[model samples]
Target: MEQVQQRLTELGFSTGGVDGGYGRKTVEAVQAFQATYQLEITGQVDESTWGMLFGSHEGQDIAADDPADAPTADRLVELCLHQVNDRYVLGTQADHNNPDEDEFDCAELISWACARLGVEFPSYSVSQIDASHHAGLGLSVSDAATTRGALLFRRAGHNGSKYNHVAISLGTGEETIEAMDSKHGVAVGEIGHRFTDGGYIPGIQYH
Candidate 1:
């Protein structure tokens, strides 16, 4: 069931995330698939739906079970929001290159979010590029940062050469949740300015 949900999400059908559970989102994904393939619009996974979905991935092996603590997309967003006022500490975690939530760095926040989902993400701002290579981790969002749980990235300094920063989407207009340096700490702020005029270039990762 988890594999099925994961497949639906990977195929861009948006089952919300592979938690092996059924809800309105899963039903909607099933209905959408049925409608797309001209299958009976039952909104239930029948034999035909299973066969088709399974057959489509003939060469791949679906996992027999999911990790007990793998966080879903919604949960990832919730966890990020839970740390709204965390102070920006430099070495809260032992590894400065790959810090955790308590470290309060931009990349560490993203890493912590992915870690909750059982996906490993480098906790350094510069090394965040590694996220693009993993499957079932998350999808890179180039334009749609408004989607909740999306991880937003911005290159910092003049001409974006100095460093990079990352944040989590609040899905509320152009706002984002992030630990914005020493003075601001962690809070929600307008993200649109980050991409306009001389601001940073915006990129996102959907967990």
Candidate 2:
């Protein structure tokens, strides 16, 4: 627990003490950290929190006001891009595939990145990207300027209401970072016209 507390402190969380217990102070500290990062105020150190402490996603912000502790956004972006060369799997947790190494899918990837950057973000469904009222902020998945760290959306057809696919904006204007599938792993692909929806949390930039 001392190690955990120390790690949390290094990640900018004020753990109050290096004690190995999750006491009220610890919970409050966790809640404070979560609130700052726009994460659900669960007051618990879940996988997402652990990922943040471990530096998996260094450039994305989980906290609205916290500036990235990372020296440069380019480093964070490069770290995320490096994972693109990895393999992808559906519905798998980021820590499961290789406990020895950190890898992720779309949702997990974004979540992990944001946590590390101390940015707050919400869990989202691929289909929710196109909903008239998204649970979070919305952006144009098809627009290049709006696609940076934005969620990519895809419809079954031109008139489909449900988004069947999702990806992360990689800032190429026409390409994005995606965890394709177990067979494909992770990679960058050109934006397809089939995708029509894009959304991202406002006031929360990925730099």
Candidate 3:
């Protein structure tokens, strides 16, 4: 619910600050979003509404001047960085587990961020890396480090092992934003190590 509110707020509607309660304000916002996008007139978020809200951008790269507002990678950066001091937990994606606030695992951070852009990245690193390879979204570590909003990961032990973590490229090649751990939580940190797998959001028109 907070994810929906935060996302709605990011896209220009005001959900009154991700307060988690699905109040009248939220209903009005969702309804406005649906109306703007030419969706059915249900104020409630349904399957089609969820898709349009979070996964409809297949080919639209640049943000449209019209009703369809597909966010860019830089926009993604702004969203992630906005949650800098948020919590971190093992399995929560966005505000799924915590309604009053947001919490994330490494990949879930990317998953949640990508959701705002209409890209559905998997909730974990192993599948995410595999899907990227199949979709040709995989990037070399060096490329990923330099590509703002690219997801970076490091794998070990074997081919089938999941990458232990993931981080987002900050575009400078020297740093990244990450939901690091329980102790460190989400923070902007130096990209000091090598990565074994990585990818970028498909619809985010990278320059």
In terms of lDDT, the best-performing candidate is: 3
N/CA/C clash count, model 3: 0
lDDT of each candidate versus the true structure: 0.55, 0.53, 0.68
Best by TM-score: 3
Error of 1 at 136 (Å): 12
Q: List the candidate 3 regions with Cα displacement exceeding 4 Å.
A: 1-68, 96-101, 157-163
User: What does the lDDT read for residue 138 in candidate 2?
Assistant: 62
Per-candidate TM equals: 0.50, 0.50, 0.61
Error of 2 at 60 (Å): 18
Candidate 1 shows a clash count of 0
Provide the global lDDT of candidate 3 against the true structure. Answer: 0.68
Q: In model 2, where do residues sit more than 4 Å from their true spots? A: 1-76, 96-102, 122-124, 127-136, 144-146, 155-163
Q: Distance (Å) between predicted and true CA of 75, model 3?
A: 1.2
Please give the range of 10 consecutive residues that has the lowest summed lDDT in model 1: 196-205
| Superposed Cα deviation of residue 185, candidate 1 (Å) | 1.4
lDDT of 3 by residue, 1-207 (tens): 998887777765555568889876577566545544545545698987788778865223232542355557766665565555467798875653332346788888777777766776688877777777788888988889888778787776534644377788876676677787787566666777656767876666566
